[model samples]
Target: MIYRMLAINIDGTLLQSNGKLHKSTKEAIDYVQQKGIYVTLVTSRSFPSAKKLAKALKIDTKLITHRGAYIANEIGRPTHSSRIKEHITYDLVRLLEGFPCQIRLVHEQFSLANKYKLNHKLLSKTVFTTGDPIVYSQQFVDSIGDTIADEPAHPLSIEVYFEYKEDLKDVQEAIGKMYHEVECIALNDLRLDIVPTGVSKLTGLLYLAERLGIKRNQIVCIGDEMDDIEMIQACGLGVAMGNAPFEVKRAADWITRSQNLHGVAYVVKEHFRKQPQIEFLQKLNIIK
Candidate 1:
């Protein structure tokens, strides 16, 4: 079948383990855009970080960011947003402070974290850059609660990092019981992302698809994480990287080489080469 849109995840799918984009990946993306295909970055990262990578690749398509809570175009104007409520944010911060985890409030314009925990390696990866820090750089606050009190309208989601499995489970359970409208997703073994109910990469993608007039079967999604599962399942062609977890690979229609091997370039090259014929058949309703 013909594919019109390519939704790619960032962390594991695009960036290598060293957190750098492959040269071939950029070439492949440019190749697809040359073929008249729409390629978008669907990630759990904040807009600033995502935008930084997209600019590096010279990608101009709309971005699905904040774990599907927000979608914005090349200029960073949000086309849609699903934000967490103020009361719920207050409740979450209060409940999480009791645990030993570090909490970060993610917003469209800026992010806020505790002053003491901003130096964590992973968190720093998101907040600081090699030279100039992007827009999503985290601001260390003395108290997250007070930051929320000062500017409650800016939050899009909450990110929590735990050192122990027990604390993670406890926080997950507490969130489940207290806020039915909130959803907690374990981005990895140690990181948990909290967004509003019904928000996901697929949700944001669907909105963008409707606006662009693209169909489900005409889209290809490539990802390598639990949060990527939904879009991987929903898109017409789902691709998983070789380094993806067992479950993610199982959910995909195909698996490519690992990130370091330039898997994204491989997929785009192989698929778009035959796209003309596929597009012909699809338009004729000869292949569903």
Candidate 2:
């Protein structure tokens, strides 16, 4: 089948484990855009961070950021957004403060984070490296509640990082019971993103697909985390990195090399080489 678009997850699929984009990955993206294929980053990263990476790749395609809560190619102009109400955001921040976790109020313009301290250093949980720090840095405040009250926050989503596994579970349960309109999504074992009930990367990609006139089977989604599973399953060719968890690999249509091995570059080079033949359109239900 002819794939018309590629949706990439920024963290594990696009960037290597060292948190850097490989030269080959950059070239591969450039190559796809040259082929008239739409490329977008469907990530949980905030807009500034996602925008930073997109700019590096030299692609102006719209980005799906904030765990699918917001989508836009530019700041202050969103084609779609499902932001948590300021009041809900306030309440969620208050709820998160009770646990020993770091909380970030994510928005397109700025990010507000609390000064929560974890006694033990959790792996990769303490640092917010999803985006370029210099481009979109967090302003640490003693009390996020107070800061938001001073100027009400318009957050697309709230990110929580935990030191204890039990705390993560507890917060999930509490948020589940306290807010039915919002949902807690586990991006990993220690980090969770709270977004509107129906928002997800899959929903975000679907919106982009419809806007771009692309079908489900014409899209290729590559991701390596739990949050990526939905988009991976819903797209035409689901690709999982070699370093992805077994479950993620199982749910994917194919597995490529790990992040360090230039997984994304490999997929683009192999799959996008073929153009859909006219006869295959009938078999793919595209010409019925």
Compare the candidates by TM-score and give the number of the best one: 2
RMSD of each: 3.3, 3.3
**Residue-by-residue lDDT tens digits, candidate 1, 1-288:** 778889999988999999998889989998888776888999877787788889999898889988788899743478888888898898788788877667888786677777555344665465332112445566777788877777774478888877666888888988888788889988666678888999988899999998888899899999998778888889999999999999999999999999999999999887887776545655789654
lDDT of each: 0.82, 0.86
Model 2 vs. true fold: TM: 0.90
For each candidate, give its TM-score against the true structure.
0.88, 0.90
For model 2, the local distance difference test gives: 0.86
Which residues of candidate 1, in runs, are more than 4 Å off? Answer: 74-76, 117-132, 277-288
Off by more than 4 A, model 2: 123-125, 276-288
Model 2 weakest 10-residue run by lDDT: 273-282
